[model samples]
Target: MKTYCFLFLIALSITQVNAETSIAILDFELNDLTLKPRTAAEINRTASIKPLLEKELKNAGYRIISIDLAMQQKANSGFGYLFDHNDVAAELGRTAGADYVLIGRLHKPSFLFAYIMGHLIRAKDGQLIGNYISETKGGDEKLTLKGVESIADKIDKDLDNRYTPPPPKHTTLH
Candidate 1:
Protein backbone atom coordinates (compact mmCIF):
# COMPACT_ATOMS: atom_id res chain seq x y z
CA MET A 1 0.00 0.00 0.00
CA LYS A 2 2.79 2.41 0.90
CA THR A 3 4.65 1.75 -2.37
CA TYR A 4 1.44 2.18 -4.36
CA CYS A 5 0.79 5.55 -2.72
CA PHE A 6 4.33 6.70 -3.35
CA LEU A 7 4.10 5.74 -7.03
CA PHE A 8 0.81 7.61 -7.33
CA LEU A 9 2.31 10.72 -5.84
CA ILE A 10 5.26 10.57 -8.19
CA ALA A 11 3.01 10.19 -11.18
CA LEU A 12 0.93 13.16 -10.15
CA SER A 13 3.96 15.34 -9.72
CA ILE A 14 5.35 14.29 -13.08
CA THR A 15 2.08 15.07 -14.79
CA GLN A 16 2.03 18.53 -13.27
CA VAL A 17 5.61 19.20 -14.30
CA ASN A 18 5.03 18.07 -17.89
CA ALA A 19 1.83 19.99 -18.52
CA GLU A 20 2.40 23.02 -20.71
CA THR A 21 0.03 25.99 -20.74
CA SER A 22 -0.88 27.11 -24.23
CA ILE A 23 -2.47 30.42 -25.17
CA ALA A 24 -4.03 32.11 -28.20
CA ILE A 25 -3.83 35.86 -28.56
CA LEU A 26 -6.40 37.47 -30.77
CA ASP A 27 -5.69 40.75 -32.48
CA PHE A 28 -6.69 43.63 -30.28
CA GLU A 29 -9.79 45.56 -31.34
CA LEU A 30 -9.76 49.33 -31.37
CA ASN A 31 -12.43 51.19 -29.46
CA ASP A 32 -12.11 54.79 -30.44
CA LEU A 33 -14.32 56.88 -28.20
CA THR A 34 -12.81 60.19 -29.19
CA LEU A 35 -14.81 62.19 -31.69
CA LYS A 36 -11.77 62.70 -33.87
CA PRO A 37 -11.30 60.39 -36.85
CA ARG A 38 -8.93 57.51 -36.17
CA THR A 39 -5.55 58.31 -37.59
CA ALA A 40 -3.23 55.93 -39.41
CA ALA A 41 -0.85 55.99 -36.46
CA GLU A 42 -3.55 54.97 -33.99
CA ILE A 43 -4.70 52.16 -36.26
CA ASN A 44 -1.16 51.00 -36.75
CA ARG A 45 -0.47 51.19 -33.03
CA THR A 46 -3.48 49.01 -32.23
CA ALA A 47 -2.28 46.44 -34.77
CA SER A 48 1.12 46.21 -33.13
CA ILE A 49 -0.04 45.21 -29.66
CA LYS A 50 -0.86 41.54 -30.37
CA PRO A 51 2.51 40.45 -31.73
CA LEU A 52 4.37 42.19 -28.93
CA LEU A 53 2.09 40.60 -26.37
CA GLU A 54 2.52 37.17 -27.97
CA LYS A 55 6.28 37.55 -27.90
CA GLU A 56 6.24 38.63 -24.27
CA LEU A 57 4.02 35.74 -23.24
CA LYS A 58 6.11 33.29 -25.22
CA ASN A 59 9.23 34.46 -23.43
CA ALA A 60 7.44 33.81 -20.17
CA GLY A 61 7.31 30.05 -21.10
CA TYR A 62 3.83 29.83 -22.50
CA ARG A 63 3.16 27.94 -25.72
CA ILE A 64 1.91 30.52 -28.20
CA ILE A 65 -0.69 29.02 -30.57
CA SER A 66 -1.91 30.85 -33.61
CA ILE A 67 -5.63 31.18 -34.19
CA ASP A 68 -6.61 30.94 -37.84
CA LEU A 69 -7.60 34.31 -39.26
CA ALA A 70 -10.63 33.00 -41.13
CA MET A 71 -11.82 31.12 -38.08
CA GLN A 72 -11.32 34.14 -35.89
CA GLN A 73 -13.39 36.26 -38.23
CA LYS A 74 -16.07 33.62 -38.28
CA ALA A 75 -16.08 33.47 -34.50
CA ASN A 76 -16.13 37.24 -34.28
CA SER A 77 -19.30 37.34 -36.42
CA GLY A 78 -19.28 41.12 -36.29
CA PHE A 79 -17.20 44.02 -35.07
CA GLY A 80 -16.46 43.69 -31.34
CA TYR A 81 -18.42 40.44 -31.08
CA LEU A 82 -15.53 38.26 -29.94
CA PHE A 83 -14.20 40.97 -27.65
CA ASP A 84 -17.58 41.25 -25.99
CA HIS A 85 -18.14 37.47 -25.90
CA ASN A 86 -15.47 35.67 -23.92
CA ASP A 87 -17.33 32.39 -24.39
CA VAL A 88 -16.92 32.77 -28.11
CA ALA A 89 -13.27 33.56 -27.60
CA ALA A 90 -12.85 30.48 -25.46
CA GLU A 91 -14.50 28.35 -28.10
CA LEU A 92 -12.08 29.69 -30.62
CA GLY A 93 -9.16 29.00 -28.29
CA ARG A 94 -10.38 25.50 -27.72
CA THR A 95 -10.53 25.00 -31.45
CA ALA A 96 -6.92 26.11 -31.64
CA GLY A 97 -5.99 23.65 -28.83
CA ALA A 98 -5.06 26.40 -26.42
CA ASP A 99 -5.49 26.31 -22.67
CA TYR A 100 -6.17 30.04 -22.48
CA VAL A 101 -7.31 32.87 -24.72
CA LEU A 102 -6.33 36.50 -24.51
CA ILE A 103 -8.73 39.06 -25.94
CA GLY A 104 -7.64 42.66 -25.87
CA ARG A 105 -8.94 46.10 -26.71
CA LEU A 106 -7.17 49.40 -27.16
CA HIS A 107 -9.70 51.88 -25.90
CA LYS A 108 -9.03 55.48 -26.81
CA PRO A 109 -11.19 57.71 -24.72
CA SER A 110 -9.30 60.82 -25.78
CA PHE A 111 -6.48 61.92 -28.02
CA LEU A 112 -4.14 62.21 -25.08
CA PHE A 113 -4.52 58.74 -23.52
CA ALA A 114 -5.48 55.17 -24.26
CA TYR A 115 -6.12 52.11 -22.14
CA ILE A 116 -4.80 48.71 -23.09
CA MET A 117 -7.29 46.19 -21.76
CA GLY A 118 -6.93 42.40 -21.85
CA HIS A 119 -9.22 39.58 -20.85
CA LEU A 120 -7.64 36.27 -19.98
CA ILE A 121 -10.05 33.35 -20.27
CA ARG A 122 -9.66 29.67 -19.62
CA ALA A 123 -10.51 27.73 -22.78
CA LYS A 124 -11.48 24.49 -21.10
CA ASP A 125 -14.20 26.01 -18.95
CA GLY A 126 -14.71 29.45 -20.41
CA GLN A 127 -14.04 31.13 -17.08
CA LEU A 128 -12.41 34.51 -16.95
CA ILE A 129 -9.12 34.59 -15.10
CA GLY A 130 -9.06 38.37 -14.91
CA ASN A 131 -9.18 41.64 -16.77
CA TYR A 132 -5.85 43.39 -16.99
CA ILE A 133 -5.47 47.04 -18.03
CA SER A 134 -2.59 49.42 -18.64
CA GLU A 135 -2.86 53.12 -19.48
CA THR A 136 -0.69 54.82 -22.08
CA LYS A 137 -0.55 58.59 -21.92
CA GLY A 138 0.25 59.07 -25.58
CA GLY A 139 -0.57 57.55 -28.96
CA ASP A 140 3.02 57.09 -30.09
CA GLU A 141 4.23 53.59 -30.94
CA LYS A 142 6.70 53.51 -28.05
CA LEU A 143 4.15 54.28 -25.33
CA THR A 144 1.61 51.93 -26.82
CA LEU A 145 4.18 49.18 -26.94
CA LYS A 146 5.02 49.88 -23.32
CA GLY A 147 1.35 49.56 -22.44
CA VAL A 148 1.26 46.12 -24.10
CA GLU A 149 4.34 45.09 -22.17
CA SER A 150 2.68 46.18 -18.96
CA ILE A 151 -0.41 44.09 -19.69
CA ALA A 152 1.76 41.07 -20.52
CA ASP A 153 3.60 41.49 -17.23
CA LYS A 154 0.33 41.52 -15.33
CA ILE A 155 -0.80 38.38 -17.15
CA ASP A 156 2.44 36.58 -16.35
CA LYS A 157 2.05 37.46 -12.70
CA ASP A 158 -1.52 36.28 -12.55
CA LEU A 159 -0.91 33.02 -14.43
CA ASP A 160 2.24 32.24 -12.45
CA ASN A 161 0.36 32.78 -9.22
CA ARG A 162 -2.44 30.52 -10.37
CA TYR A 163 -0.42 27.68 -11.89
CA THR A 164 2.90 27.50 -10.07
CA PRO A 165 3.41 24.18 -8.35
CA PRO A 166 3.89 24.07 -4.62
CA PRO A 167 7.47 23.78 -3.38
CA PRO A 168 8.51 20.18 -2.93
CA LYS A 169 8.70 19.07 0.69
CA HIS A 170 12.20 18.66 2.08
CA THR A 171 12.76 15.49 4.04
CA THR A 172 15.53 15.65 6.65
CA LEU A 173 17.96 12.80 7.02
CA HIS A 174 18.73 11.95 10.62
Candidate 2:
Protein backbone atom coordinates (compact mmCIF):
# COMPACT_ATOMS: atom_id res chain seq x y z
CA MET A 1 0.00 0.00 0.00
CA LYS A 2 2.81 2.42 0.88
CA THR A 3 4.63 1.63 -2.36
CA TYR A 4 1.45 2.19 -4.34
CA CYS A 5 0.92 5.54 -2.67
CA PHE A 6 4.51 6.59 -3.45
CA LEU A 7 4.12 5.60 -7.08
CA PHE A 8 0.89 7.54 -7.37
CA LEU A 9 2.50 10.61 -5.87
CA ILE A 10 5.39 10.38 -8.32
CA ALA A 11 2.96 10.08 -11.21
CA LEU A 12 1.03 13.13 -10.08
CA SER A 13 4.21 15.16 -9.84
CA ILE A 14 5.24 14.09 -13.31
CA THR A 15 1.90 15.07 -14.73
CA GLN A 16 2.10 18.47 -13.13
CA VAL A 17 5.58 19.01 -14.50
CA ASN A 18 4.44 18.08 -17.98
CA ALA A 19 1.54 20.55 -17.96
CA GLU A 20 3.32 23.54 -19.43
CA THR A 21 1.68 26.92 -20.05
CA SER A 22 1.10 27.67 -23.73
CA ILE A 23 2.00 31.14 -24.97
CA ALA A 24 2.07 32.76 -28.40
CA ILE A 25 4.83 35.30 -28.85
CA LEU A 26 4.18 37.83 -31.57
CA ASP A 27 6.95 39.48 -33.55
CA PHE A 28 8.74 42.28 -31.73
CA GLU A 29 8.07 45.68 -33.24
CA LEU A 30 10.75 48.30 -33.53
CA ASN A 31 9.67 51.75 -32.29
CA ASP A 32 12.60 53.95 -33.10
CA LEU A 33 12.26 57.48 -31.78
CA THR A 34 15.91 58.35 -32.20
CA LEU A 35 17.23 61.23 -34.25
CA LYS A 36 19.48 59.11 -36.47
CA PRO A 37 17.92 57.00 -39.16
CA ARG A 38 17.45 53.30 -38.50
CA THR A 39 20.37 51.17 -39.62
CA ALA A 40 20.64 47.61 -40.83
CA ALA A 41 22.05 46.52 -37.50
CA GLU A 42 19.11 48.04 -35.67
CA ILE A 43 16.64 46.20 -37.85
CA ASN A 44 18.53 42.95 -37.34
CA ARG A 45 18.56 43.45 -33.60
CA THR A 46 14.83 44.11 -33.54
CA ALA A 47 14.25 40.91 -35.49
CA SER A 48 16.27 38.82 -33.07
CA ILE A 49 14.24 39.69 -29.97
CA LYS A 50 11.28 37.44 -30.72
CA PRO A 51 13.35 34.33 -31.37
CA LEU A 52 15.50 34.95 -28.35
CA LEU A 53 12.44 35.45 -26.16
CA GLU A 54 10.84 32.28 -27.56
CA LYS A 55 13.97 30.30 -26.78
CA GLU A 56 14.22 31.66 -23.27
CA LEU A 57 10.57 30.99 -22.49
CA LYS A 58 10.72 27.53 -24.04
CA ASN A 59 13.70 26.64 -21.87
CA ALA A 60 11.66 27.81 -18.88
CA GLY A 61 9.01 25.16 -19.70
CA TYR A 62 6.55 27.21 -21.71
CA ARG A 63 4.91 25.54 -24.71
CA ILE A 64 5.46 27.94 -27.62
CA ILE A 65 2.55 28.45 -30.03
CA SER A 66 3.86 29.90 -33.26
CA ILE A 67 1.83 32.65 -34.93
CA ASP A 68 1.90 32.76 -38.71
CA LEU A 69 4.02 35.59 -40.10
CA ALA A 70 1.56 36.60 -42.77
CA MET A 71 -1.34 36.71 -40.38
CA GLN A 72 0.65 38.68 -37.85
CA GLN A 73 1.80 41.18 -40.44
CA LYS A 74 -1.64 41.54 -41.89
CA ALA A 75 -3.40 42.01 -38.56
CA ASN A 76 -0.80 44.22 -37.01
CA SER A 77 0.02 46.58 -39.81
CA GLY A 78 -0.29 49.95 -38.08
CA PHE A 79 2.18 51.38 -35.61
CA GLY A 80 1.87 49.72 -32.18
CA TYR A 81 -1.21 47.83 -33.24
CA LEU A 82 -0.56 44.54 -31.50
CA PHE A 83 1.37 46.09 -28.65
CA ASP A 84 -1.42 48.52 -27.88
CA HIS A 85 -4.45 46.37 -28.66
CA ASN A 86 -4.73 43.60 -26.10
CA ASP A 87 -8.08 42.51 -27.53
CA VAL A 88 -6.57 41.74 -30.92
CA ALA A 89 -3.70 39.92 -29.30
CA ALA A 90 -6.07 37.80 -27.21
CA GLU A 91 -8.15 36.94 -30.24
CA LEU A 92 -5.04 35.93 -32.11
CA GLY A 93 -3.91 33.84 -29.19
CA ARG A 94 -7.26 32.07 -29.03
CA THR A 95 -7.14 31.35 -32.74
CA ALA A 96 -3.65 29.94 -32.29
CA GLY A 97 -4.74 27.79 -29.29
CA ALA A 98 -2.58 29.54 -26.78
CA ASP A 99 -3.52 30.24 -23.16
CA TYR A 100 -1.50 33.46 -23.11
CA VAL A 101 -0.20 35.93 -25.66
CA LEU A 102 2.88 38.11 -25.48
CA ILE A 103 3.21 41.24 -27.61
CA GLY A 104 6.66 42.73 -27.53
CA ARG A 105 8.37 45.92 -28.68
CA LEU A 106 11.90 47.24 -28.72
CA HIS A 107 11.59 50.97 -28.09
CA LYS A 108 14.62 53.06 -28.92
CA PRO A 109 14.37 56.54 -27.52
CA SER A 110 18.04 57.34 -27.94
CA PHE A 111 21.17 55.96 -29.55
CA LEU A 112 22.67 55.01 -26.21
CA PHE A 113 20.10 52.47 -25.07
CA ALA A 114 16.75 50.85 -25.77
CA TYR A 115 13.94 49.23 -23.80
CA ILE A 116 12.65 45.78 -24.53
CA MET A 117 9.02 45.70 -23.42
CA GLY A 118 6.17 43.20 -23.52
CA HIS A 119 2.53 42.95 -22.59
CA LEU A 120 1.18 39.65 -21.32
CA ILE A 121 -2.50 39.05 -21.96
CA ARG A 122 -4.81 36.23 -20.88
CA ALA A 123 -6.26 34.79 -24.05
CA LYS A 124 -9.51 33.49 -22.62
CA ASP A 125 -10.67 36.75 -21.06
CA GLY A 126 -8.48 39.29 -22.85
CA GLN A 127 -7.14 40.66 -19.60
CA LEU A 128 -3.78 42.32 -19.31
CA ILE A 129 -1.94 40.23 -16.77
CA GLY A 130 1.53 41.73 -16.83
CA ASN A 131 3.71 44.36 -18.40
CA TYR A 132 7.42 43.66 -18.47
CA ILE A 133 10.44 45.63 -19.56
CA SER A 134 14.23 45.48 -19.53
CA GLU A 135 16.80 47.99 -20.74
CA THR A 136 19.79 47.15 -22.90
CA LYS A 137 22.69 49.53 -22.75
CA GLY A 138 23.81 49.22 -26.36
CA GLY A 139 22.87 47.60 -29.68
CA ASP A 140 25.04 44.57 -29.02
CA GLU A 141 23.43 41.18 -29.48
CA LYS A 142 24.69 39.94 -26.11
CA LEU A 143 23.13 42.84 -24.21
CA THR A 144 19.80 42.49 -26.00
CA LEU A 145 19.78 38.77 -25.22
CA LYS A 146 20.40 39.52 -21.58
CA GLY A 147 17.49 41.95 -21.56
CA VAL A 148 15.23 39.34 -23.14
CA GLU A 149 16.32 36.83 -20.53
CA SER A 150 15.43 39.26 -17.78
CA ILE A 151 11.94 39.84 -19.17
CA ALA A 152 11.44 36.08 -19.55
CA ASP A 153 12.39 35.50 -15.91
CA LYS A 154 9.95 38.16 -14.74
CA ILE A 155 7.12 36.73 -16.83
CA ASP A 156 7.74 33.27 -15.40
CA LYS A 157 7.61 34.59 -11.86
CA ASP A 158 4.46 36.62 -12.51
CA LEU A 159 2.65 33.65 -13.99
CA ASP A 160 3.61 31.44 -11.08
CA ASN A 161 2.49 34.00 -8.56
CA ARG A 162 -0.83 34.57 -10.26
CA TYR A 163 -1.68 30.88 -10.64
CA THR A 164 -0.53 29.41 -7.35
CA PRO A 165 -3.29 28.97 -4.81
CA PRO A 166 -3.16 30.66 -1.47
CA PRO A 167 -2.48 28.68 1.68
CA PRO A 168 -5.53 27.47 3.54
CA LYS A 169 -6.47 29.22 6.72
CA HIS A 170 -5.90 27.42 10.02
CA THR A 171 -8.62 27.61 12.64
CA THR A 172 -8.91 26.03 16.08
CA LEU A 173 -11.98 25.76 18.34
CA HIS A 174 -11.51 27.80 21.50
RMSD of each: 9.3, 11.2
True lDDT of residue 127, candidate 2: 97
Candidate 2, 24-56: lDDT as tens digits: 999888889887747888889999999988988
Whole-model lDDT per candidate? 0.85, 0.87
**What lDDT does candidate 1 reach at residue 145?**
66
Clashing pairs in model 1? none
Model 2 weakest 10-residue run by lDDT: 160-169
